[model samples]
Target: MSAPKVLVVLTSHDKLGDTGKPTGWYLSEFAHPYDVLNSASVSLTVASPRGGLSPVDPSSIDAAKDDSISTNFINSPSTKPLFEQTLPLSDFVGNPSAIAPFAAIFFPGGHGPMFDLATDPQSQQLIREFWDAGKVVAAVCHGPAALVNVKLADGSHLLKGRKVTGFTNEEEDMVQLSKFMPFMLEDKLKEAVGPEGAFEKAPSAWGEKVVVDAEGRLITGQNPASATGVGKAILKAISS
Candidate 1:
């Protein structure tokens, strides 16, 4: 078999909910996973809702400039082209035959996905197709926002009966943007999964927590710290 490939979807929205301040995918949220997945010999295609130039959430890096992954993702020449030339979401639309070839699709979190991916029809269908095809679907932090609106073939929300985790309401409040977000990530996830679906959380804010469905196809990470963990989980899923 050919080497497995994973599609890493980033958010194109640049504003943090009407705050008029800029926001986008958190650098480490993508970088950590990129680093891990790359180390495992997995190829990746980076894409965004509108494509080209996935914005950097400045706050995510401003404080973590010294972090190894954050530093490399922001300044390393090796990574420059990937972020600058992101493909448009259209590249993956209307082609299940094409989408089916991917072993998995991942959404890296930031405030931005809550604005775009949650409602983007292409994103929703791409996820549904990947899930229906029995391929893996993964997301991290606010990235799980992408799955909140995805409905399975049975017309039930994909998250309706699955266990998952993401940025918690407590974490949002800790960031003091609880009111700034369009909606609480935790609350919305709980509602999407319905009463039977479970939303587990990390013991502490910014802790690393990843949730992979029993079958190993549906994966989620709790926050930025969970990136690498999620990446490893994806590898294990596809490797099986």
Candidate 2:
């Protein structure tokens, strides 16, 4: 059995709220998953909407305040290379054939994704290609917002009836970023799919809640805390 090919996508935006403070991808979001997949020697590639050394939230590196995985990844030499060598968005503007070689795709998030990823038609198209090929598509935090407008070949919403998880409206309020976020991700899902929609979230923001909807190969995480869990689930689905 060969190691799996994994593509890890990060965000390039660098501001949250009106503070004008730099905020890019959450370190935990990339660190946790990278550690998990790295353990198995998975071939990983980091890409972004604009790419070129995607910014990482400086706060995520605070040793005393981060999860173990986050701390470990920042301490690892191999994983750290991703932060230094991310591929540019223009590299895959037209659904490049290179993406199809990967076994799975993951979108890591921070407030940055809320600015660009959620509405990128090109990125969504890349996601659609991976899905249509029956590959795993995993996202954590606001990364799931990228699926908001994705449509299948049949013209149905990709997440229409999928029991997935992502950054919840409640958690957004907990972080006090609800207003700064382009749109309420949870509310948008509910509004798009209605009461019977399969969207679900964890009971607590810190609790890991990763859902793998039976309908499609969609996997989601509620927030930064759930990134590892979401990554594990993605690997499990692929290795199964």
Taking all chains together, each candidate's TM-score versus the true structure is: 0.96, 0.90
- Candidate 2 lDDT, 1-240, residue by residue in tens: 677888888887788857797787888887777778878777788888776778888866663264777876766786677876789766755665877668888988777877778887777887888888888888888888777878877998878766777788888898787877779888777655555567787776667787887533678888877878877887787777
lDDT of 1 by residue, 119-165 (tens): 99999988888887899999999999999989977898898878999
Can you give the lDDT of residue 35 in candidate 1?
Answer: 87
Clashing pairs in 2: none
Model 1 CA deviation exceeding 4 Å by range: none
lDDT of 1: 0.89
Question: What do the candidate models score in CA lDDT, each in turn?
Answer: 0.89, 0.77
Q: What is the Cα-based lDDT of residue 89 in candidate 1?
A: 81
- Model 1 poorest ten-residue lDDT run: 92-101
Q: RMSD of model 1, in Å?
A: 1.2
The candidate scoring highest on lDDT is 1
Instruction: Specify the highest-TM-score model's number.
Output: 1
